[model samples]
Target: MEISMSTIAFGFIGFKATDFAAWDSLDYISKHRDQGEWTGLYIAEDEATAKGYLSDKINNSGNGIAYLHKVSVIRPGKLITCLDQSFKTGNIDIPALKQAMRDKGINVEDTDKLTEKLGQLGYYFRCFNNEDGAIEMIIPVELVTNVDMQLYKTCIAKSFVFSCQ
Candidate 1:
């Protein structure tokens, strides 16, 4: 599909650690590693600029898929979250982000696979464009069990901070 400059420029924001109790958007999941649940708190950027840009992203595509074909970011001191998953791998050197294209069906990806080949990579919240110019995100295995958050691990399976839909 041909993407106009306006469409390409549009995108949504994922406030991974933010929560919106007013909107009732937060889930009740306890574990970040649980299946099909977002494990972190994420805020939607509703500012006019963000909302407008994101609107374009939503209309210009079908679904969003994450691709990890680049290993350059695999080094230490950085956290990589899986916003989408669509790539071939071994040691997961991964691929560079391709030019933004029409959204496709959201890919079902596991966080463990990406973290399996790294030396020092911690998982974190990721953001991308899916329907409505927003994509889903999840924490990698490295960030699954935090030493400090162990007490509240049994909260449920809804964290919205990072996980699946």
Candidate 2:
């Protein structure tokens, strides 16, 4: 993700995705995707373009998204972005899940493997459709590049501030 520094840029700036208010949104992808701490850094900064950009990036970047992100725009003009998805069953407690991945550390293979692990963990497997199933996953800030996500948000924020259309 990239953002313009010369804009009305304000994001959950941190080295880790756990620091973001939207950190919990990662669970929607798969509770265990973040097990390796690879799920955070998906928040948007109240701009439709920004949210759309990140969504495209996450989908195209080999994440192979299972959950769909919902961008809720309030009457006061605040965008409440939420991401949710279905889980695939697999191994959940691999040693690789001990910490988060580094920059460019995430891949399609990793995400697929994580889905397997979530199934193994039972948390992801428990998500029931049409019955309001509960899935519990923790998204620490150490997963994805908070800087990149913030940059995207900032750029879109700036562009929105300046654009007439």
Candidate 3:
């Protein structure tokens, strides 16, 4: 397929990481290595960006079916959420923010710390309703190709196809 800048859009780089959830212990990586491609989907702008993102993981100390998925749009919908995962991971400094709260005489704990404490108190993944506060993205996302890990790492594609409908 003849690749174009417009044709190549959103891509997701699959990776391995131990601390996928806030409840996971900090020592989790040391105690037990991740067994497979982690559940969290790290989305990138395109194939090149995905390659750059996954380059370090290729030679890392674990083996799994690493992938770069070219997601083509079948239909688009507004993905509305109160917490955008990307924003939290990219912008927020959870530890520093927690410290700032404590400094202000408000005994604040990190989400992980709070989650752990709450778990001990028999509370799990609690939710509360909020009005008029939301974040939404209309991303057309249907996997177009499971672009080979080798192709992505080596920066060459011999037999990968992309189809957008």
Name the top TM-score candidate.
3
Model 3: lDDT of residue 108: 41
Q: What value does the lDDT take at residue 106 in candidate 2? A: 28
Q: Give the number of the best model, judged by lDDT.
A: 3
lDDT of 2 at 57: 28
* Model 2 stretches with alpha carbons more than 4 Å out: 1-38, 54-165
- Candidate 1 lDDT over 55-109, as tens digits, reads 2222234332211110111122333333343321212223322122213221223
The C-alpha TM-scores of every prediction are 0.25, 0.19, 0.26
The local lDDT score (0 to 100) that residue 64 gets in candidate 3 is: 27
Which digits, one per residue and each the tens of the lDDT, describe model 3 over residues 1-165? 010111222333231211112222223323433322121123443444444443343333433223444433232221212242333334434466346435644344665353233222222121111222222111211111122122222222223222211
| Model 3 alpha-carbon drift over 4 Å, by segment | 1-39, 61-67, 80-89, 93-165
Q: Model 3 TM-score?
A: 0.26
Question: How many residue pairs clash per model?
Answer: 21, 18, 0
Q: What would the per-residue lDDT of candidate 2 be over residues 9-97, giving only the tens digit for each residue?
A: 22332222121234243444454343442333233222332333433323334342222232221111111111223222332333333
